[model samples]
Target: MLNFGNMHNSVWIGVDIGTTGVRAIAYQKNGVNLCDSNEFYPLETPYPDWAEQNPEIIYKATEKVIRDTANTLIYKGIPVSGIAISTVMHSFAPANEKRELLSNMITWADSRSVEIVNELKKDIKLTRNFYEKTCCPVHACYPFLKILWLKKTFPDVFSKMKYIYSLKDYVFEKLTNKWVIDKSSASASGLYNAHKMDWDEDILSFADIRKEQLPPVVSTTYSQKLTPDAAQRLNLPKGLPVVIGATDGVLVNVGIGAVKPGQLSATIGTSGAIRMLTKNPKVDKKNRTWCYNLTDDMWVAGGAINNGGIIMRWMRDKICHYNSRRLDDIDIDPYDLMTLKASKIPAGAEGLLLLPFFTGERAPYWNSELRGMFFGLSLNHSRSHMIRAAMEGICFSLNCVLTALKDFGKIEDIRVSGSFTKSTLWLQIISDIFGENITLPQNSEGAAFGAAVLGFIASGEMNSISDTANLIQSKKIYYPQKENFLTYKELFDIYNNLYQKLQPEFTRITTYQNQMYK
Candidate 1:
């Protein structure tokens, strides 16, 4: 129970429906964090490359956090002005006319529709047409392809589905009994026309669905009141205005105050993305990046990598099992210990290179068949060398996205957020690899803070979104080291060449694995 009694008279609550958990943060108008609460939910992978979650569990988790945070604030007599929501993008769940979920929510990481994506890629005309309209490429992660996958494999469920909704839309329906989605979430679906701000009839026809099956698109700052039942269950005041925030990825830009033209924001959480704000939709000629709306006039153009801090979790569980488990006894956090061990190794990991595609990949190369590989292992290498290489590999993957982002706008500096900022070593690694200065904001709550900013704007506390950059403060700045940048520049070439050289093998391996399963 945190006290907010002496804090600023005005406070706003922001709820983030993240991939790993649900978090609610209470923030003052000046961007100070009053209190926060979080609850984790299980992510199920019943088969390989298939990620799913129960909508009911997610809704319950959302309810618990909101209740916990709101009650704490109210107990302290802090008047909460409004509530806002931010959620993960590209999540799909089918529901009946009554709004009853007909299937588990399919997340962005799920690759069950990979084959359909590949098939669409073979038809350049169709793929390019959709990409030109939606600003999202033909990928298994997009709901457009996912709908085709459902119709082909689960026709019974597909036929029964009266509407398709993203995770945020489903949660909104649970809270307000409304079927409206924000423009940012709709833009990521590969079904919405960015220019028109509506569902694309052509794409819908390709997926064998109609426009009526999707929620109506609304602005990111759209607001609705919480229903009476929802208000009572969450211990909130009836008719509390709920501001509809944008997708977490887009809102992260707002949260970090990266609304300027040349400033890029990178978030390295379970997955990672590098985005820049633009006045107009910026579509890549090569169709490698996604352009999603933050508002009617503003769009976030960037690429996302499916693997980020998740690879570190894998190393802890499988490779450093003993060391990680014993960290508690040594009074050291496991990740800190891991970083400490890796620091002993020299830069470039002493000639070892790791391509971290453990969970396939995204951005630059949307190849789901690509697997993780350590390309330059030697007999002299130790576990520490592998750990250092893993860290470098993750940065290298993000650098690839940064390279693609240059086509849209010039990146002057990077404002970074996410759990990875906990490690100074990781921060320096990203700085050196990108050859740019990295700034960490004082309020590193990311999307949750962005949602609060939206609430402030909606409640007339803040003048505009750009005004938040002046309100938020920066904590630290990490500059790139010239020597390390040179080393990474050389290694990055090998990193790119390794992927190209291994592309054929990746496809062959996928073929063999499929035959074996058959």
Candidate 2:
């Protein structure tokens, strides 16, 4: 039994629609967390290289979490000020005129459109032009290629869809009966022009879709009142203001208090990204990074890796199955056990190397045909060694993004968050690999806390988004070690060289697999 009378003056809620689940978090004005609740849904993979989820299932989970969190706060006599949302980017579903989903939402991890992206890449000039306009390369994970794939493969569904809405947009319509998409999510679709802050006509024409088929793009801070039905479902007041927040990547930067130039944020969750705030859109000459709009004056410039902590999850469930299950039965966290085992291994994992790309990869490579591999395995290598290599591989992959971001501006220290922070060993590995200090926030709520901050700003409880730094306190810091950095530098060189050497083989294998399956 907690005391509700001792709570702060006001509280705001942040609803995060993530890849694995939906979380509704309540935070006080000063950044103290009052309560949080989460509801998880499942990812559907009917075929290899395909990832999707039913929108209605996700909405139901969202409703449950929101209602649970709201009821918890209300029970404590806390008055909800406002609510904001943070959602995964690059997910969209076809919908009818009634805003009902025509198909499952295609997630960012889906690689079914790899063939479409390869075809688009055949025209180098056109690919470069689109990349310049949208700041997203020809990749299977992006909605631009997904749209092309859908139109080509499912003509009937394409013809019937009245609108294409991202997961956030679909949920927003359910809550408010209004079709709208934030510029941050829109910009990530590879169909929106960051410079013009509108749908790119050329890209839309290429995808064989019209502007009218997409939801209207709105600002990040755009707000609307919840519908009476939605309000009742969540047991909240009718007409409660809901702010349309930015995508998870941008909000992660905000939640970690990386709002200014020279500040970078590295978030390793189910997926991972390394992002930095910039005043203007920073486009890489090599087109290896993304520059998504965060606000009218701010842009997020960085790269994302499709594999992060997910690779560890894969190892725990598949390779270390017996140990994981045993640990679970004993009421111990399997990841903690794995990390403890990994810490006993040498810095280089005894010459073992893992690619960490179970679902292809993003950022820097943007190659969906690439697959995971474990190189330099020997008889002496144990499961613990493999775990260390996997963790190191994840760090090296994110370091690729950090190196790319350095081309745009200076990054002295990285503000870190997400599931990766739970492991001190992983944090030290990240610090050594990046050769910089890793700063952790007091509350590692990631995107949800950022969404709450946005809600506070929208409701006039906070002055500006820049106040995020003042609101968060530094919890811990991990500094790079000299010897560890040197060893990682050598290993990273091998990791980089191995990827280039394996590119042709990756393509060949993908082609053979697709042909065999067909």
Distance (Å) between predicted and true CA of 262, model 1?
0.4
Q: Whole-model Cα lDDT per candidate?
A: 0.86, 0.87
Residue 366 CA displacement from its true place in model 1, Å: 1.8
lDDT string for model 1 (1-518, tens) is: 21222234668799989888989999887778888899988778655677899988998999999999999998888767777899998999888888788888999988878788888889998888888899998888888888999999999999998989898888887787777999999999999998888999877887889888898888887888888999999888777778888899988888988888798899998889999988887788888898999877788999999888888887877888856456778788988888999999988999999899876787978888778899889999998999999999999999999999987767776899888999999999999999999999887777998998887777666767787777667899999999999999999999999999888898787667656645
Off by over 4 Å in 1: 1-8, 322-330, 514-518
| Residue-wise C-alpha lDDT for candidate 2, range 489-510, written one tens digit per residue | 9999999999999999998987
True lDDT of residue 172, candidate 2: 86
Clashing pairs for predicted structure model 2, backbone only: none
TM-score of each: 0.95, 0.96
